[model samples]
Target: MANFNEDGLKKKLDDLNMSQQSIQTVSLWLIHHKKHAHTVVNVWYRELITATDSRKLTFMYLANDVIQNSKKKGPEYNKEFGSKLGKVFEHLGALRLDEKSLRGLNRLLNVWEDRSVFDADHIKLFKKNLNKGHGKSKENNSRKRELGGKHDNPQSKKRRDSASDAIQPSTPESRLRRDSEGDLTQFAVSPQSSTPPSDPPEPEQLIEAIQELENAATSDALVREKIANLPDEVSDVNLLNKLQDLAAGRALCDQVEEALSMLEAYNKRLAEEMEARKAVARMLHDYIAFQKDLLAQAEETLEEHRQKQGKVKKVREELKAHLQNLPDISKLPSIRMGGLAPLPSAGDLFT
Candidate 1:
């Protein structure tokens, strides 16, 4: 969380001796891929750039700044054409962030960065990333410090001594006397004590410890047995009952393992049956589609036949009318009955 923001990055970038054209090319590329660049940097960009050479570091900062500032939409936005020209330094390879920077970029493809709208899957993934970033090593060291295994600072040591001096040792008689008074506040830190009271442990820390213990018990037989025997020392009835229940559950699980195997087989068979039914349903759907197509073709053929029949009937009617309109040869003329006079003899009749 150093001053790795845009201004700081740009200042670093200005220190590099890259050519203007190369820088402009890089800037244009970043501008073209601004969205992807933003997403890549937001999640996986390390705050620290560990480069041996100052030039390389400058280039990295340059690339980082260009990507970061691309999303600004106000007056301060980089409106200048060559504003991201420092990007050319990335070609040196040293300017590139680790390839692992791609890890969280894919997660942002469809995810809204706003925490409020996260679904269960998104929340789960966010928690996983959180756990990855703040891993068990930090928690382990914290626990070691809590258990007094870590070296204390001189000031803390003196404070602890002062607090210890303020507390009084209790004997059975003193305990009985205090019990008679029914007052427990007497053991509280005195107001005049120079040492400040330690802050109460966070609920999250307590929950993490409980989960670790539960996981240890489940994973290790020795730890499980130790937990089962814990009630002997604590002498808490509720704790004992819970331990008994846990043991009973473990025993029951072992007893039912064969049954679980049978159930698994049954489930597998059921899944297979369901898949088969789905396949059959798909085939049936295809068959129905094919039948529908055939029916459509048949209907089209029937329509064409009907059209052709109508055309044939029209033609027949026209022919019949034409035939009826024609004059009757018997009424029109009897060639043999003499519609004209006979021809005269060629020579004598003429004279």
Candidate 2:
């Protein structure tokens, strides 16, 4: 089991060729298991078998294969993707150790034998790190020395003073603290202080944050940077380009949905305008010309009837006047009328 896990882990470490800090996550998990548990002396285990959730395992398990060296020495392109992979180390560093993690480690060690996925170089790298133990002891020691000891530690003097102060009478157990002046176990790191360093950040935190930063960078950093910096006016244009590519991808169904919504809105407006134009066309065809023709015919008929009626009415009125004047004329028969205008046309009478 140990061999199986080792082989796969080793391959990843070599492939990334990342800094020891990057691969150090898996190493740390292993060391935690190595020091604390009934660690098998032999082969490592399969990664899948031991993990309750593949995602959780992958979260802590996958190593950043891309070395953080200069771009020239490292991957030539897509540095963001490379960096994203490196972020896993930071995430692993952030995780708080617990019993569940121990189970994962046990599973990891149990399956390392049969699955020899790693090449020789990666396997060698793994051994180097694993054999070195967790970097804590060395780093802690360095810190202590840098404080005051000849070592790189920064707290040696204070630690020594505390040791002197805690001294008790010649009780059997008290003798250890009294005799062993620099016993770290007796140094009484607070329950809170027993935690890893806060300033440098844990390897897990580094992995998680770095991964997120890198994830935000995306697969193609070149195009991505442009999209990020695009002017507000051209922002939609950038999105349109992405939507076009996403359509090709077909996997980003959300883009398709958004495009569909825009198209639907356009279609709705077009349909409304088409209905309005159709109503206008109907108004022209049904009402305007019909009313004008009807009015014109009515005007001509009324004019013709009015002229004929007026002629008849004029003749009748003149006849009535003549009748009334006949008696008057009788009294004055000397008034002659032989040259009067003729009005005896038969066609003018009401037939």
Candidate 3:
């Protein structure tokens, strides 16, 4: 990725196109360096102002992609772009846009309004300014056409119209129009993976699994105690000296065999418990990763809420200040009964 500097950003903008891949690639890079969102937005606006009319819509699309997608990760891009979008709309609106360009711009505005990407008031103001600019441009074009028509010879005008019609079929703008229309269609359909995402493990299930591992080796306390207190005679041959007869020896042999069987059973249980522990370890690792992702998402949401609260607070304060500065309505002079001139009588009017 290129460094998030003004020069690097300008270079990227220069290469930007209407293709979904191009816009998304640039959006991802911008979102990655969201800490520099302020600089990025400034650079974007400056470049957009200088960009040709054909490229202006592409810049808007890039901004839209970044603002919408970056919200899940952080609000930096949205905040920065939100502040500058009004001016962006005004600039684009002032240009002589074709039908397709105007339609594309309207579509973008509708999407933002529907998504509530910005406050309703802001969106309304943006749309108003955009229309105002376009209206001004239309008026100017209308005046120019009227002025030109006054001096245009009928034969010359006909020839010029014919020439325009002949050349229109081969114009680059026509090709761009087709390509951009396709690109816009593609952009509208958000990309998704063919495979659906797997859900995280349930908290209850995870807790139960962990709890089961607590006594996985042996849940039988008595058996565990008995194993711990096993006699040494089971493994010691020297104890045979204490045997007084064949019956005693046989009894010792029986005790040793029982001990051996118990130890073997315990060993097998321990091996199974170890395997269970390994599986639980893997599960815990995945669960922890999933939890961290959730935590990050939550933090992003919290930041977005804080930004919204701050905006509302600021607006409220401004309104309060504006109200305070207004003159009191009650202190203004009031009209008295004789303040107005008397009306003429109906009889006088009839006479």
Residue range 1-351, candidate 2, lDDT tens digits: 122255655353333212222333333333323322122112222332233332344333332111111122223222333333223223333444343342332222222211232334543443333323344443333333323324424465554443322211123343344223343323221212111111122345444544544333134455446445544433254454554555454644555565556556655655665665554455444333434443554476578679999999999999999988676644553424654556668887856
Candidate 1 lDDT, 93-165, residue by residue in tens: 2232332222122122112222122245643453344334444454343222322322666565444333222
Give the whole-model CA lDDT for all candidates, comma-separated: 0.38, 0.36, 0.66
Residue 333 shift from truth in candidate 1, angstroms = 11
Looking at model 1, the pairs that clash are none
Query: Is 1 or 3 the stronger prediction by lDDT?
Result: 3
What's the count of clashing pairs in each model shown?
0, 53, 0
What lDDT tens digits, residue by residue, belong to model 3 across residues 206-321? 77888987777667687799887887777878887878999988888898889889989988988999898877777776566545644554576588679999999999999999
Better of 2 and 3 by TM-score: 3
Which residue pairs show collisions in model 3? none
Give per-model TM-scores: 0.23, 0.22, 0.42
- Look at candidate 3 and tell me the lDDT of residue 121: 96
Model 3, 307: alpha-carbon shift in Å? 47
Which segments of model 3 are wrong by more than 4 Å?
135-351
| Ranking according to lDDT, highest score first | 3, 1, 2
